[model samples]
Target: MLTYTPPIAEQRFVLQNIVKVDELSGHNVFADVTSDLVDAILEGAGQFAAGEFAPLNRVGDEVGSKWSPEGVTTPPGFKEAYGAYVEGGWGTLTGPTEYGGQGLPLSLSSVVMEDLGSANMAFSLIMMLSPAAVEALKHHGTEEQRRTWMPKLVTGEWNGTMNLTEPQAGSDVGALKTRAVPQGDGTYRIKGQKIFITFGEHDLTDNIVHLVLARTPDAPEGTRGISLFLVPKFRLNDDGTPGEFNDVRCVSIEHKMGIHASPTCVMSYGDRDDCVGWLVGEEQGGMRAMFTMMNNARLNVGLQGVSIAERATQAATRYARERVQSAKAGSASRESVRIIEHADVRRMLLRMKALTQAARALAYYAAGLTDRGQLGDADAQARVDLLTPLVKAYGTDVGVEVTSLGVQVHGGMGYIEETGAAQHYRDARISPIYEGTNGIQAADLVGRKLGLEGGAVLASLLSDMRAGAAGEAPLMALIEDCEAVAGHLATSSTDDRMAAAYPFLTLLSVAVCGWLMALQLRAAEREDGDSRFLAMKKAAARFYLDQVVPETRGLRAAAMAPAESLFGLDEEAFSA
Candidate 1:
């Protein structure tokens, strides 16, 4: 099993030095967010995740989530671990204070989630889904709905899920056929099936709140007609206790490649035509409400990538330090040396650490900006909008890259499941696909986010990167590349922009990450700290700038490639 040490020091450094979380305390909304509070959160979350969650990861994978006609049963110890999480108040860190929450900055919750996800990615999804639901209710749900649902979700006494995907409607939410009909009592009768609903029917909690997307009869066609609804597994009584079945049933759980304990359910709603739901937000406004939830989930999904990458880096580093192999090529001694002594292994380890740190930096930076935006910083909000797709797309891409490298570093043992390196790879494989596929993330970035403030958002980001680069030539060149590509995207046809989206996304993401790394390098060099840790930080920062940032050059060329190469290919050409 891979033992996860929560990288507490690294998180503290990023929050304090890089993201400068302490500065948030100056805002009225964050008046209570002190250094001690931040430290307490990181420490407490680390202990719970490592002690209660990590040990169950292996069993969770082996036994997986069991499916019965009644409901889905999570692997052994998961229920208890979840109870402890709720009791410890881990989930309430970012919830509204009026709703029994701690009212901390959202970034603090990101820090906690990184640790938890590192320890157990599958279990962390249960925690992750609830916050998205909370955000949706906070932004769009009625006041009564908030009073009814927010507190329980905040306290983790109840769980929540986003039911957007159906069997026929995967990425195209507009294609969903789920119907919501008014029942004349200010409620709705929801009838449809949803699939790939994570934690949709888990037994960890007695009640599950589902934020489902459905269309009311007589509504306009397409996404404009879709409405969001609050449908629960069990209806609440007058006293707000679980009373009767709400006709939400889990037809089955998917057999998956990884994160086996997280139930990806096929949910059938209103099988008996009795499923009751309350309309959330206005009818024909589901897309707007759903985006509020989705944008939140997309960022956290990116955080999942960072979390998994961190764990894989630690596992690989430990293995490289302990696994003995052939001696140095030019050494006189015949004695075997640890694999870390070998150049290739050292390269892999350094790349893993550097990329993991870059991903974490990107995620934390976005989180910090989110807090600033919440505090009424218009520019910060604009930057966050531009960075959201980058964080979601790039962070998960790094997660997949680093975990795969973790497996390679373990050599043959990594191939076997017991060593745990392979599991990291498998678990990470889903992140780029989850929330929204990385392709969609790329498309969103180029098609919409790049156009924010008429391209000023991206221009400002590039200008800041150029200034912060401090005359680093490679970064300067990459910034130029991003600028040129942004101009191209703005002028290009729809097909051209779509064709360029993926690579353009990578190009811009690496540029931003490289810029952040450069800033961290300066901070690390100035800090008077443990020589080894600071030295490692400096090395990783330098490695990323010198090695990783250059990859963007090729990406830039690919981003500007003609759309004809893609559209020119017929369907048969892709069929092998």
Candidate 2:
């Protein structure tokens, strides 16, 4: 059995020292959310996760969710766990107060979500998608739409999903073929098949609300033609209760390598002629509206990456402490020593811990940026936008790497089904692939973020890095790396621009992560006594700077190279 414990002390270090939750409460919008309140929420969430969610994690993987012609059934204990989650109001933490939510800040909710994911990622995902759907509706839905669905969704009586992928259009929204024809009766008939829809069909909720993206008859070609709509599993009556079953049906569920508890469905919309949907926002504006949720979803997915890595690291660390193997060097007897005493095992464990901590700091910093964008000074929004892709892409990329290290630490046991480390590795594999793949994230950073405000965002970020370092050696070295790459991008001509952008983005991610680790190290320095927490932070920062930051050089070379190297490769050359 996996002995999982939330890193409560480390979480406090992040919220208090790294991000400064107290500083956020000083803002007017967050005046109601105090540090004390945040602590209490964290405590409650940690307890609930350990008590309610952790126990079912293995059970979920063992039993898995079952699918039949009738409907999909979640693994045993999921329904009761979900009911407890709803009753505890965990689902409504970030929803609008007008819709029966607690109206907490995204930062607090992010902390709670990290705990949930650490406890049980598959179970947590079902709750995670609901608020994202509610956020989309809150931003773009009409008054009637909000009145009819917000209460149920915000209360967790119903769950939500985003339907975008088709058999051929995965990640390429422009290639989507879903069609929606306006009915002149203020509704539209939707016809499309959506694959890889998470929580698409679940028995936990009375009804499932799908925020589907499709195209109108007269819509433009490619992505410009895309539009979003609210399609429910069951049409609602005037009384806000589910009426007749909507035309949506689950054709099948994917048998994935992991996260077996979370059903990934292939759903058919409008298999019958009566599949109805209401427009969200306006025609040709669906992608824009979906971005509201997609952006949030991207950040949450990053946290999922961090959460899984943390859990895996904890499991591996605990296993190392107890699992005895060969005797230590110069031992008098043949008595076995704990695996943690072995140098190689210790190195791997340290790498896992360091990477997990660095990734956690990056994710939390991004969440703090979100809170700042919502309630801080006017200039904070740009900073938030710049870090969004870094948090989403870099964090998840590190997550897959760290979790894989965790599995490696356990040797053959990690490969065994019962060890549970394999599950974390499997669950993390998807984080980098979904919510805009990491490649797209890299492209967005170079194409959009670097160019935001005519390159002022990148410029401002560099300036902040210099100021934050204050001539400290480690920090100054990182800032210099950032400037060198930025200068390369700045001076590049049109012919070499795209080629330069790729490596620049990769180097930029490393620099940002290194800078964050430096900040954490600085904080650890200020704390009194040789506490393990502070020591771990310092060690992790050192390992990241020495081992991880050097990768920027290779990335920089790649970014500065000619694009033809990749594009000029012969397609037929590999056949031999």
Candidate 3:
């Protein structure tokens, strides 16, 4: 079986030294996190992910999740592994201490997530859902709601799901048709069919808190009228244990391209007309509340991209080191040499490592900004607003590319299921599509985020990226292209903006990741560290700068092209 060895050293190096969780230690939310505690936590999370979760990745993919009249049954060992996970308080890393959580910085939680994703992407998802719900509830839940559900959800005794997508509504959440009828006692009877609900109907927990988006009878039209509701699978008893079954039912789950172990269900609310939901924030305020969870969820999905890349890289590099192939170019003997000795194989391995490492650093940096933003840093909030989309779109794009390279490295064996390279590729396919498609993310960067503070955020961000590129000529050249593209995006017409957003976002993402990778190298040079690892870090930065950074030129040109051709395509012409 293929295995995952957590990059504990690299994680600690980034968190403790580079991103420096200590910067946020001054905040009350992060006050309890000491260096010793943080180290222990990282080590523990790594152990859990590798020893417990990694062993389950293949099993989960093969067995997948099973559904029946009794609900969903997870692949074997998932429930037990999750049980151990919660018992060890792994779920509490980012939860609030008031609700029995550790309250460490999100950057720390981000590192833990990397480990978990590397181990078992499907299983890590169940853990991810609760946290998004926790964030929404933590920010929007009423006192009674918090007191009742926060502890259970945070501790992983229960799970949660986001219910927004329907048959007709996908990204255009404003088109949703779910309805809510006020029951006069501050409760609402919710009736809707929500699709792509992960962990929606599963035996992992008796009570699954689903945050649903619905429309009230008297509410206005469009997204402005949608309201958020907290609907539990099992009705709560007077004493807090699950009482009767709520009207939430799993109609079916998706037979997807990847992450099969994760049950993506089509959920029906009020199937029996008895489904009761309490308002989460206020009526006609669902989109606002959902975005709160989504911005962070977008980040989580981006990290999934990073996780898959790490797993694929590890598998491919291992195979390269062991798989004996052609002898070195100048070798005299007829003896076969390991693939790692071949130049092209080494290039592929280094490229995979470079992109994965850059993506990881960029993700960790964005997560650090998340904590800073939460701590009332206005600049950090602006940074988060801008970086979130790029992280999701670019990170996942790199993930797909890197995983494909992993398959390339494995040669014939990669095509076979037993090598496990294909699984990472299959699992990564969903990251760019979910939590807002990469296209939407790019448009968000170009249209919404670029307009922040009358375009000062994008301008200032580019300025800093240029400054960071100080001595690196390739990065400097890329920064210039990115800055020019930003200028075009800032002034482009709506049609042009829509056409160029994707390439613009890709160029900017590459520049930013290159910048972060540069930062990692400088930090490595300054700090007293492991020589071999530090050398590897410098080498990765070099590869990213030299081999991968040139794509920005082409991306910039495509981004600057006219939108007319795209708009001119006829429906039938487009189909061809």
Best by TM-score: 1
Residues 1-576, model 2: lDDT tens digits: 475687887888888866788888777777778767887888899999999999999988877787888889999999999999989988888788888987777878888899889899988888777888988999899998998999889888999898988999888888999999999999999998999999899899889999999999988889888889999999988788999899999988999888889999999999878999999998889888888888888889989988898899998998899899998777787889999998888889888887788778878887887778777455567877887787888778878988898888888999986888899899889888888888788777766777788888788877777766564565566567666766666666654666665556657777777777778778888887558878888998888777777645566557667667756869886675
Candidate 1: count the clashes: 0
Model 2 residue 176 CA deviation (Å) reads 1.0
Minimum summed lDDT over a 10-residue window in model 2 is located at: 469-478
For model 2, what is the alpha-carbon lDDT of residue 546?
75
Better of 2 and 3 by lDDT: 3
lDDT (Cα, 0-100) at 426 in candidate 1: 91
Best by lDDT: 1
Which portions of model 2 miss their true places by more than 4 Å? 329-335, 470-475, 490-503
Backbone clashes per model, in order?
0, 0, 0
User: What are the Cα lDDT values of the candidates?
Assistant: 0.91, 0.83, 0.89
In model 3, the Cα lDDT at residue 452 comes to 91
lDDT of 2: 0.83
